[model samples]
Target: MICLNSLGKRIAYLRKRSNLTQRQLMNILDFENLSRYENDERKPNIDIIVKLSKHFKISTDWILTGQEHKSYRNFQHKIELDDNEKNFIKLFDQLTEFEKGQIIGRMEQLIEMH
Candidate 1:
């Protein structure tokens, strides 16, 4: 039987790789007070699992049952997001609100120019 504790660990691991904090991930999953689940203090049910899988864009089966050959859950194969593709996320995190708006305006102008 797959342990709920282990499942929580996998969830936390993938969430971190996605560059999301527990609070941020919980917001997307619409689960309040989700820290306990990530910390393995509480178990998440099937409904939560479904939401989590969808939010992370991964297979529920893959998340629950890790690959037989690997020690980790290998979500990279399940969800591919290259650095170049998600660079805007890094910039958005680093930039201030005003700076973000300026960058958006610049991008819009560049797009219009093309």
Candidate 2:
């Protein structure tokens, strides 16, 4: 059950948290529809929802209702997910370019060892 207000807030939060401008969210000529979806003036159709969920690799239920799938959450949260995975990724994405490079270098080392 998607309440329009909550849904809109969720969408806006996710978009901003993901560091995307509304224009970057959809390829449509007019950016108003995506704005409307974030503003609670409109709801995206099921197709749009499916596309977004797949692209984000997020649970549709979480998008609609803010409840994540349990297993993935558990696996990702051993470091203790106070917020959600999206928020964690968002923070990581916002890191400085140099910081990201350093992190990626360390990650590569970890990957090569495994």
Candidate 3:
């Protein structure tokens, strides 16, 4: 029986839950090493781990270990956002209250102009 402790199992589980095929994930990751990772033939390096974690919006700790984190557990429906959209949201969220208001005001102005 495969246990959650196995990195391969965790990855495979996530991939399936996300409703993605190995080929789809491979295309998205742009890496051919996924097969090895899923097979437990090899472990991903820190950089690869970080990339996967960010891509999946999951904690590295949870990925490396079997522990279910609240963040991962409460994961909502999959919403695919490209890098630009993700970056924009991240930057926007980091803005101060006044800054955010200013940005929203600008956005509203732009929308009105359209």
Q: Whose lDDT is greatest here?
A: 3
Winner on lDDT between 2 and 3 is: 3
- In Å, residue 31's CA in model 1 sits off its true spot by 0.4
Counting only residues 3 or more apart in sequence or on different chains, how many pairs clash (N, Cα, C under 3 Å) in candidate 3? 0
Mind sharing the TM-score for model 3? 0.56
Cα lDDT tens digits, model 3, 1-114, are: 656778887888888879999889889876777878989999988766766777798878888997766765556345678999989999986776579889999999999998
Q: Quick one: ranking by TM-score, best first?
A: 3, 2, 1
Residue lDDT tens for model 2, 40-101: 78988866776567666777877788787788688766765556876867887668657877
Q: After superposition, how far is residue 88 of candidate 2 from its true place, in Å?
A: 31
Query: How many backbone clashes can be found in candidate 1?
Result: 0
**Per-prediction TM-score, please?**
0.51, 0.51, 0.56
Specify the highest-TM-score model's number: 3
Counting clashing residue pairs in each candidate, in order, gives 0, 0, 0
- Could you give the C-alpha RMSD of every candidate to the true structure, in order shown? 10.2, 9.9, 10.5
Where does the lowest 10-residue lDDT sum fall in candidate 3? 70-79
Q: List the residue pairs that clash in candidate 3.
A: none
